[model samples]
Target: MHPYDTIVSRDVDAFPLGEFLDYPRLMSVDWREEEPRMLSAFFTATGLPADGTTLEMDDRTSYYQLVRGSDRVDVPWGDEVSAQHSMLVALQRVFGASHSIRYLNHGCADTASFVVETNEDWRRLESANPHVRWFFTPIERLPDVFKSDIDELVRVGETYGGA
Candidate 1:
């Protein structure tokens, strides 16, 4: 199991292009083909040279790495509910909905991956967004190491109020 998982949009245009322009780190992923207009706007909003911001991956593996990296470090993408909730809040701020977001299980799922500290945190996240649907493999079915990490996160959340 990978340490982290990624959430991406099946339809790139589902994201709020205008709102995302303000997030420099989040906008660092290559989206030239996915949404050129939004990418252009992001560059303009951040004052980043358009040519400089355009990321060119040499292969599909590199592209996947970049996308996963961006998800791990950027907004609305994290292993834990808080991180995901933060993303949801950001989307709501832009008047966006939940139809396009998808969780990718294969990219990252290591022990160091993000996750809620406790079951309560997970419950809260679910309660907060009843309509949101998470698509990923079940925790019990994951490798022992990944399961242990998740268990540790739950314990941490129980003891420290979250990781």
Candidate 2:
């Protein structure tokens, strides 16, 4: 079955993004085919921060709900590192983990891989949108190590070596 066969990702090699191998995160995404509004949903799903401004909203939870409902809404990822990582993870979830190359790639393929974490912020994001019930199609869970989703983000983040 292909990655798009279901909203969730399987541990098989059904999807292959060979052309995306070098993109890291930002470039790999074919945003023309993806909805950027999903970024907020990604942030909420991964339990990461969007920005300090987002903190000022009177009803942030409701605001996020609105953001998740549409793909045209624009969201500014104040934390560039986390935002890019979230997006990359989202893609891997849509794809698979075996695609991770020998080294400097996404996943536990090397010691350079990093870990995905969950903390208090999860509550806020969860309130905004529950991970289980939220996220668009082709994404069934938060960016995780199970698929090296978080590791892939870290590899791309630092592998550039100040890129």
Candidate 3:
């Protein structure tokens, strides 16, 4: 399993889907035949400027890359705790406390993809809230360092369908 670079909520309307198109580091590669003008127009409609830097095409696939200055954002990719914290902050910024934020991390080969169920208690956001629900592959498949963490999460979830 690979660590997820993107987190998506299962609910389509949980947040504004179009906001994802504006993410600075988002890069997409599509294997399709389409006109350049059409691509440009699509990007423009999604709030991306029609500058030359927004799109790229190769013999194999066509892709869009959203580039921005690195100074603008700080994303945590190396540490799990940091990454979780970062995601919590992002979800709060995007959806606030009105919605139950369920997100999936599309992990890669070396990392395990997991789903986080963010309700009031998850992430210790509110004292009155309940515990967070974390879902992942079996504990045997996780790294040694992560095993205990997963076990604890499982133990917590056993009472509330968290696993």
Pick the TM-score winner: 3
Better of 1 and 3 by TM-score: 3
Report, for every candidate in turn, its global Cα lDDT versus the true structure.
0.29, 0.30, 0.31
In order of appearance, the predictions have TM-scores of 0.21, 0.19, 0.25
RMSD of 3: 14.1
Off by over 4 Å in 3: 1-80, 103-148
lDDT of 2 by residue, 58-104 (tens): 25432221122122222223323233333444333432332211122
- Candidate 1 stretches greater than 4 Å from native: 1-106, 109-112, 130-138, 143-163
Give the per-residue lDDT digits (tens) of candidate 1, residues 47-162: 44544233234353332111221332123222442322333222222211211111213223331221211234335544554321232222222332222355543343233221
Candidate that scores best on lDDT = 3
Q: Score candidate 1 by TM-score against the native.
A: 0.21
Local accuracy of candidate 3 as per-residue lDDT tens digits, 101-143: 3321122223322222234324453232222122222222233
Candidate 3: residue 41 Cα off by (Å): 22
Positional deviation of residue 135's Cα in model 1 after best superposition, in angstroms: 5.1
